[model samples]
Target: MSDETNNEGLNEAPWRATILTLYPDMFPGPLGTSLAGRALENGLWSLDILHIRDFAEGKHRNVDDTPAGGGAGMVLRPDVVGRAIDAATGEGDMRPRILLSPRGKSLTQEKVRSLKEAGGAILLCGRFEGVDQRVIDGRNLEEISIGDYILSGGELGAMVLMDAVVRLLPGVMGKVASGEDESFESGLLEYPHYTRPTIWEGHEIPEILASGHHGKIAQWRHEQAVALTKERRPDLYEAWEAEE
Candidate 1:
């Protein structure tokens, strides 16, 4: 059975996310708790969980089968996943259909912003070995990976993706500029941040921070962000340099 968890009094045309997965209960888990959760409750966005098993045929209601050509794990059937995709998206839905996979392009801030602007997304979580290649291509699903490592399933990746996108939705964050200087927003890792207790463990907050000069503080932050990115992510640093 499908579960619709949209709150009452929703904003007209709020961002929508429809997740297709065997583990329907996994959704809105973390997405239902923090800033994303608050936004969900305020009707800034909506979530619909579609159980892939609901589309399976046969008395056993099996959705996966032994991988063809011999493999250790079962592969999600194209027919079953296809039916689920079709059910989630009707004619002219226009929202991007995404399949979370390890081999897909790496997820990035730019991609997250694009998704936010796209209005919504339909995420399909692959379990076991993965979904059949035919359905991935046939359904026009764009695969995305959160990192180089692998997870047991795509549910976590889907949540990660949703969290990144939801926080960018207008009115979700306390301040619009709050996201402006974050890591990757400017193609660099964010600079270090400090709070209360100016002097801690014999180490005082950087003098430049307390100088009361906004211009110098901005300069210091940018330099720190550049140095940090260059040291840890030379690839990003080079790309950022090239763009400049």
Candidate 2:
């Protein structure tokens, strides 16, 4: 990530982000690659990193402690984490503050689009068991989870969320419409994709794709998308049907 501060030349920044984590080095990790990296270099967005431990009171820089009630792991202290969040945001900052957690509302393409439209976000990457719930409630943090499984830390989840959102920002992707029909965008999984070498390993590409009939091709893609969604994700298929 850039050494540039979040408030650096505030007027010129198109998109801004601030990550609060115990492991600041993990940032810009994958975001520093491919489209996201290029966007960062082009100033399409700006990232600011904040280390949560910096707010800890003791010499050990202990940001977490044993859970109050009793648990297998530690919980981030509310006061320290709250201070970090306040440092990133001041009065009247409208950017949505997000916390990456397993129990959060599942992240969706619609949510990603909303975040992109906002042009910025403050992401909190929790470690240990989780953050003190008080900070989450007091800071008005929108908790978001990428999937059903768990990760070792929220840094990776934050990166995943950022990558998903950043690619949708203006000029990041080559074609704007390219993302519109992707998985979950239409409440259905995307259709299968095929390339040259029509026949590979004795498996032939779908005939409709090769028919050169634009209308039929479009119909075929829509049908395949529906079938795939219904087979792979019954929940999404049901929602799609309900919408229709």
Candidate 3:
């Protein structure tokens, strides 16, 4: 069940990602484009797609079965998922094992940063009703949810998580500062962005942004970010205020 291949270059222990999912072909889809793609090509990171069904039992290669307590949908078999996890990550692997599920703790920028620091992760893409709870506990997997809503499967969520983490990897993005000023990095949504033409549809870019004063510009951005966060997410604004 290991279709694990490292696109590693010499001496570079790139951030590794081993995704356990039924849809193995869905991997590196968008991640193989843009900054993440370039990083992968540069050997700044590696991807290993572990097809969960590869470890399925029986002639059908069945990975999921009816829900244990009479659910409307089937649940992924713990044994199958367990086998996939084991095959992807061998002994002594220090990477954290994660399961993508709506029931999990909401994923955040802070968590992504932690995973980036870890240099890798083992992501389990749950399908059907969900993976068996017992296996989740036994494997010590960290469950994560992308949002409050549900998706058809966890494949997209895993990709999203990886995309966020990969962009922060050293040398992945054009500028390290890009990640720092982003939304949630400073407990506030990002400030507005403006570009040349300066006047978009008769709306001028903020006057302060055009002032050419670095200190003033920085102050303006901070103020804008604070105001925006307070208006849109008062909870975050409160937390940010508490820290100040």
Residues 66-169 of candidate 3 have per-residue lDDT tens digits of: 98668598988889988888898887998999999999999999999999999899999989788899899989999999999999999999999999998877
For residues 155-230, could you state the per-residue lDDT of candidate 2 as single tens digits?
Answer: 9999988999887776677665677878888888999999989999999999999999999999999999999999
List TM-scores for all candidates, in order: 0.95, 0.92, 0.93
Clashes of each: 0, 0, 0
* 65: Cα error in model 2, Å: 1.5
**Which numbered prediction scores highest in lDDT against the true structure?**
1
For model 1, the stretches where C-alpha displacement exceeds 4 angstroms are 1-12
Please give the TM-score that candidate 2 achieves against the real structure. Answer: 0.92
How well does model 3 score by local distance difference test?
0.88
Best of the two (1, 3) by TM-score: 1
- Flag regions of model 3 displaced more than 4 Å: 1-12
Model 2 has a clash total of: 0
lDDT of 1 at 5: 32
Report the backbone clash tally of model 1.
Answer: 0
Candidate 1 lDDT tens digits, 1-103: 1122334335456799999999999988999987888888888989999999999999999999999999699999999999999999978899999999999
